[model samples]
Target: MAEELQTATDKLEDEHYPAYTMGRAAEMLGTTPGFLRSLDEVKLLVPQRSRGGHRRYSRYQLRLATRVRALVDEGTGLEAACRIVILEDQLEEARRINAEHSSHQPER
Candidate 1:
């Protein structure tokens, strides 16, 4: 029982674990599988395939999908939304790296 609980707990926080099947992911995102397929077509978030040839999504991918869904709900074209999300992500990573580098620098 404890082991089962531990496994569930780990899955709750494992960002890269391919835990969600296509139907489940789509349901959770309040969208359809075709929508996810469209995102895949644009190379926005590629899901991992299970050994039995099912598409599996991780938490990270779900987050991206959620962002895309939000943008699409706001009337953004899928391709443009993908580009915007990618740019936002890149900008965020740059800010993080800059902050880390600034913190590591010694005062002159």
Candidate 2:
């Protein structure tokens, strides 16, 4: 019983788990399914497809969609918003890697 509970908890915690349908993800992001489709079209946040061919969104993808929605709400074009969001994510990752590398360097 505890193991089953833990499995459920882990699924909730996993950002990469495809636990949300496209419609749910769109609703969570306060956007439309068409908007989510545009993100997939731009290859910015391609959601996984279920066995029945329905799109399944991970938490990570929803977050990306939220960011893009914010930009789009600010009057940015969809394609440009996707590009900005992708660049921002890449920049954040690069910064994290640089910080980790710097922290591990020996005093010089």
Candidate 3:
């Protein structure tokens, strides 16, 4: 009974999680599997891996891939484009966090 309950719980968790396999992620992002793997190899987009060694991509990764595609469409090389995109994304995220933090602070 306990084992069955645990299995059910695990299934529920999996269903609620935003996890995607490599092939599914590629399809969602409108890219080839090889291209996704190359992005990972280049450290442009790293996905979470399961204990069994399967790749799991999140929604964040799919968004990043879309950004990468846009940059490429703008005539940027893959490596350079990825670097620029990552830097810009980091800066934007930092600014957003800072803005949220400052909004919560007591105004002078």
Task: Give the best candidate by lDDT.
Answer: 1
Q: lDDT tens digits, residues 1-108, model 3?
A: 999999877755663344888989888878889878878999987787889888787777777888888888799999987898899889999999999999999978
Q: How many backbone clashes does candidate 2 have?
A: 0
User: To one decimal, what is the Cα RMSD in angstroms of model 1 from the true structure?
Assistant: 2.4
- Give per-residue lDDT, candidate 3, residue 10: 79
Candidate 1 vs candidate 2: the TM-score winner is 2
1-108 in candidate 1: lDDT tens per residue?
A: 999999999988899898999999999999999999998899998899999999999988898889988998999999999998889888998999999999999999
In the range 5-47, model 2's lDDT, one tens digit per residue, is 9999999999999999988988888878998898888899778
lDDT of 1 at 58: 95
Clash total of candidate 1: 0
**Per-candidate TM-score against the hidden true structure:** 0.85, 0.89, 0.76
Q: How many residue pairs collide in each prediction?
A: 0, 0, 0
- Highest-scoring model, TM-score: 2
Could you give the candidate ranking by TM-score, starting with the highest? 2, 1, 3
Please report, in order, the local distance difference test score of every candidate based on alpha carbons: 0.92, 0.91, 0.83
Off by over 4 Å in 1: 1-12
User: In angstroms, how far off is 106's CA in candidate 1?
Assistant: 1.3
